[model samples]
Target: MTVEHREAAAQRQEAGAGGPQAAPGRRRVALLFPGQGAQQPGMALGLYRADPRFAARVDEVLALWGAEGRAVRRDWLAPDAPDVPLDDLRRAQPLLFAVDWALGRTVLDWGVRPDALLGHSVGEVAAAALAGVLTLAEAAAVMADRVHHLASAPPGGMLAVAGAPEQVAGLLGEGVVVGAVNGPRQVVVAGAEAPLAAAEARLRAAGLNTRRARTLSAFHSPVVAPAAALGLPVLRSVALRPPRLALHSGYTGGLLDAATAVDPGFWAGQPAAPVLFGPALDGLLAEGRWLLVEAGPAQGLTMLAKRHRAVASGDSAAVALLPARPGDDGREAAAAAAVRDRLAAEALLPV
Candidate 1:
């Protein structure tokens, strides 16, 4: 194995060493919610169709947005429906928020309680709801209003760069900003399309992997500052509460402070704040033996979690509750069963 792979394996083994065998019943587990690019037209269709509880929860959250929610549900469920609106930031944010939140709630109802929670990008809204820091309606409102403000901004794009932040930092030019640090080797840069495309071309020319993320605006960059400012009042209107679960902040790259969690200004700035996922994962890994569950429509976060040094080293395991792609036959049920089986085997869930 390469040195990097070897190191990751070691970390994983160290993380998994004592807990599963010593006190399986109390094994630690962390829940992760994904952000944009994770959405699909038929995502969660199986779960929503076969599981009434799951469907009801999805509807309940969707109801919070009124007509927009209903329209999203229609497109999300209809056969042969195009993912047109799902690509629009204004609509996508709230829809993804509801789906991810519903999935988390469904897992909780199935007795799979998380010991900690982390969220990526807009996924943080759902995480906040699950942590009891915000209600479903409030999260919906935050997401919708945030997107509304964002829609008013000029068009931009994001590029997923497969390199360390330090490596990519030097490549950024005017308008470009580090949108997210997903892992040691995975960073997302966002800005106007012209600058973003130029950066991606340069990175690829240098033999670094780069791809355009499916997004409408340059989220987590200076481009969204105006939107963030506009959304501040909307964010402040929502009531805040202390998290019922341990909540990690992707924006801060660590556990969220209680004071900051309840601050509207903190949330207001989050729209344009870089997602510090890698550092946040490091913090969660320090707690030891966590089962990182991706509670969203896609396995994007789960894939990133698996590549983390901790998981690669065998210090932890990561699983996705849903398929990364839309249209996979029975994949959702299979994924859910896989999670259930793993939790049961670890004694985290009652058999």
Candidate 2:
């Protein structure tokens, strides 16, 4: 059977243990990692201070980058630190990778293990590492090198358009590309500045709600081809292993074939490949009911996940690991507490 078929069969078997009368607690759990634009300064700060395990994992990831990484972490976690240019894709990618990976580790340490994993865009690197397909150091190196290569690309942008995929695709003229299919009505477009601006303007003029994604360059577009090529060697150098958990691919919008998951070229092309988040997520939900936990700085992916039919039908639940925004003094603490409470209530964690 194909990976998807196998996974579906496995999920059915797992769910069948309790038969039709099985309680909802028998459903599998999934951990999601967010891509770019979900990051924020001081993300998970409360957890870092209140939980040593979380703090240590964050520190461990920073250590991989040596002194520079340490400095970034210092600024990142500082309560009163000035706003760093996290808007720059080069800096944001690695920092976000570290935060996501650290947060995933923290969740696992807390005794909430996911049966399946999915990540969007750069988030996949963290998922790969956490699933044991790549080491933390390897993930960090790949992320850093990816940023370095992408930084050299020409300026570009991404826009989140609230419309059907076909509606969004109709607007992709010339340089523009459909970056991601977030949901049935949520599609992300990316490309050079001019095309992006034109498309955004047109979409808004048509009474469609749209927002500019905070990104330095148009990812998952042809503009990043050179960067993708340059980063291939970095990915190839990393030692890879089979994932310890089922890992869905954001690129293919489905479960990853074991070989493709470890292929260097696959990793390299991901940056320039359209993210089929909506489809991939659909497939994951097909496996079984899941508690979708967003292990990232914000709730962007969590919000998107909620738009899925399974989630909307109450077959699954989605929660963000960190506060959706920064600035509030105790937001992280409250969010963390809320997550724990929700998990316990859902029987995902010990009460």
Candidate 3:
């Protein structure tokens, strides 16, 4: 889950140590926010407690959740045992939004504003908020709305298959569909519990390896259509505006244009459509040699960003703010220091 590429700017610039040269002009910064399975309980907890600027931003977002913010804070810090499991969107969605937004804000504080924003699945809401498509409060409400509606949908889950989307397309049954095209060879199939299990069996029989995404409900699949459809009315009420900064849509696998930004249907329909994250990253990197920063945990987005063609040629680079998991006690501080050192080596840290 880490970038082992020896060609990485961090490695190349290691000898420079604390001295950061002017960064490569071609690689403008782009902050990446991760979605559901990408997070673990207590992810970045030390960073949150130690960094006031980061903590302030996180608190600001969670405050928008009102009284429920207390529960979100408590559960996220104590991932192992909580009133609601992090796998449940009801708890996961709002918390992820807060963390993602705060992490992005922290990067912005370093004086290098990102040229673009990209997010996967629930991560999109955070990206949208950061891009000015929706205010943080509005985005929080929309996420809360999503949580409420999903309460009635059939319980479902997702299975990650080792094949291209087309390779898995033929095996899909009634509820099973491509939930996400994560990489060149990985696609996640999702549906109602029974149907998803059946789909997994089919893929396994076909000699394709499969694993479940960490969740109790299937997002970005047909199984969640009912919930998405039901939330459209509330979703439409949010006042949408064009992004002040660039944003690539995981749902559309392209940039977020002004027209699409204001379209409530585009936002409401996200859960029902497959997440085209790989294509969206392609669009972002294709725009320019950019510094892609994973503003969330576990280096998941960082790993994905590193796989792009842009990174291989030094046209772009990627970094993750937090280490693999959170609640590591003493290790969290050390991990953050290491990441900052890497950034410093790449001259990506603020001059």
Candidate 4:
């Protein structure tokens, strides 16, 4: 690693009073950022209002989009926002990035140093930025371009199937394919609308439970090839560098390395690539005892982490900074504080 890279690693591993050496035998912290499926109405509005640092960081990220940023913040804060606005790629992509990036950022501002960063799907973009692989500006531009160009790809959707990836893969047709392998028994199929619908029917017929992810665009499949192809130039223009913190990538299903970090093609190809979050999580949890803190909306990633042997066996734990439901912002603020209090009790928070 270069000198700059080494410095970033130092910051993550030894920043603030919560650094590893600050408390002997404290579990190392790993922040988890959930991807697209976790988005919900009024998500994180509570924390955004309760925490000024989080709000500022979120505003800074959204500001990179100029006018579009203002509209997103406005819509995001509106109590009467559309019922399923989170499914719109244009809205979901940027807002999720802002929430994920800012939430993880403010935690660090409080001196809770993380040993590693992990994100699922678009959440990976936030993880990359926090890890020092890409700047917030670069991530915002890339995210904006993603929603823009992906509109060219024919309307597609994803179907989450339970009970083995092989079963789901076996049911796919020519236009549809396996999109993500989320866990031992959970996988997703992605394709253009008609084909994906047909595949979903087939999975249901086979006695597998299925649900569509809240996305208008089908990610992690060949249908996104056109968008990924179009976004190549924009991705390459960004000056991506090596990670400052340990980053486990869902794209590569392992620790993100210097070579892959700077590869524009690799970044562009993510849309057309299968998300192996299970494998990546396996690698991360195997490294050591960890306190996996979900910094994004919902407790989705935390629930997934709980299924792991490490967390199940009491070797590690997980916490979601935001709640699972979408009713009260006041309760949301209190919930986040309660989680942080638990972290403090565990010595994961700063001294």
What TM-score goes with each of the models? 0.90, 0.91, 0.88, 0.92
- lDDT against the true structure, each candidate: 0.80, 0.81, 0.78, 0.83
lDDT by residue (tens digit), candidate 1, 144-196? 78877888988898889989898898888777989999988999999988998
Task: Name the weakest run of 10 consecutive residues (lDDT summed) in model 3.
Answer: 1-10
Give the candidates in order of TM-score, highest first: 4, 2, 1, 3
The clash numbers for all candidates, in the given order, read 12, 0, 1, 0
Off by over 4 Å in 3: 1-25, 334-351
Query: Clash pairs of candidate 3?
Result: 27-289
lDDT of 4 by residue, 1-351 (tens): 344445544565564322455455567889999888788888888777777887899999988999888888888888476533767877888888898999899788878768888898889999999988888888999998987888678788988888687777888767898888878997878899998888888888888999888898888898888877888899889898988778889988877777999999888888789999998888877766788999988788998899999999999898888888754548778777887898888877766
Measured with C-alpha atoms, the lDDT of residue 82 in candidate 2 is 43
- lDDT string, candidate 3, 123-226, tens digits: 88899998888888898888878878886777889888889789898987787889899788878888889888888888989999998988788888877887
Candidate 1 residue 91 C-alpha distance from true site, Å: 3.1
Decide which is better by TM-score, 1 or 3. Answer: 1
- TM-score between candidate 1 and the true structure: 0.90
The clash number for model 1 is 12
lDDT, candidate 2, 182-280, per-residue tens: 888988899999988888888888889999898978999999888788988888887878776778889988877678878889999988999999988
